[model samples]
Target: MRVSMDLELKDIPGQLVLALKPVSEFKGNLISVVHHHEKKTPRGKIPVHLVFEIKPDHLDNIISLLEESGISVVSVDEKRYLEHGAVILIGHIVHTDIKDTIDKVDNTGYAEIVDLNLSMPRVNRPSSASLKIDAVSKQHMSAAIELLKSIAKEKDLLVIEPIGIN
Candidate 1:
């Protein structure tokens, strides 16, 4: 399967090789690599565009390995991140690693967080967040909600699920 990946690597010697190591390690068929050195993010990292083909099953490993090596995966193919649903999570949202929470859904391959709005009353208290998650279809959206519920519970957050979804 053809997969697209956007990565940001730390600007340093050998960073490019370190960035491409994961793809080659996974035996992925390389399609292209667009290294944008002139463009730097707020953190001064360089953006990289990678396209490759690999067995569907190898995707998770490739992603995991790349992340383990400290590459920031900005985005991946959202093939199933089309159908959507919204949910609200209330609690220590920021303290609990909000990005990790969003990643939990996005990594599922069937869903991703499309948008998020957070309301914080004070700098030191819990907050409420509204999130829109897109999935492959309505059923996938439901599954995404289920996954969100599980993650939220683990983080001691309260979940206000979809109105009409059982």
Candidate 2:
């Protein structure tokens, strides 16, 4: 598949070289790389744009490899990046570390929480949140939902699925 990737690399010598290694190792034919050496992210990393082609299955491997190597994969072509869905959670959400709960879905690499709305009536009372999640594709939605449900159960939160239909 043809894909474009946005990456963040530490702004040190040889960092771009290290970032390109994963694409090569994963058998991605390099089409081009646009590295903005003059620019730096708030975290002091350089922004790089790359275009390439590789097998669909190899895409995930390369992304994972890049992350494991301490590079941040900011975005990939939406054609394979994700599909959007929404869900709600009701219960003691804030008490359970909302960051961790969100991370559980995002860490999967196939699912992510893109937007969220939270409501807490009182400090001692329960809370509810509407979460907008994006999965790699239609096929990954169920897996993402299942993972959300599991996390809800562990966190004593209630999961409301298939949002916006009813």
On TM-score, the leading prediction is: 2
TM-score of 1: 0.51
Task: Give all TM-scores, in the order shown.
Answer: 0.51, 0.54
> Candidate 2 residues 1-166, lDDT tens each?
5689999998778888888898898887888899997898888889999998676788888998899989999999825544678898999998899999999888998878999999999998999899998776666788889888998999899999995332
lDDT of 1 by residue, 1-166 (tens): 5688999999989988987787898898788999999999989999999988766678888889889989899999823244678899999999999989999999998788999999999987889999988776677789999999999999999999978885
Which residues of candidate 1, in runs, are more than 4 Å off? 1-80
Model 2 lDDT, full chain set: 0.86
What local lDDT score does residue 85 receive in model 1, on the 0 to 100 scale? 82
**What is the alpha-carbon lDDT for the whole of candidate 1?**
0.86
lDDT for each of the candidates? 0.86, 0.86
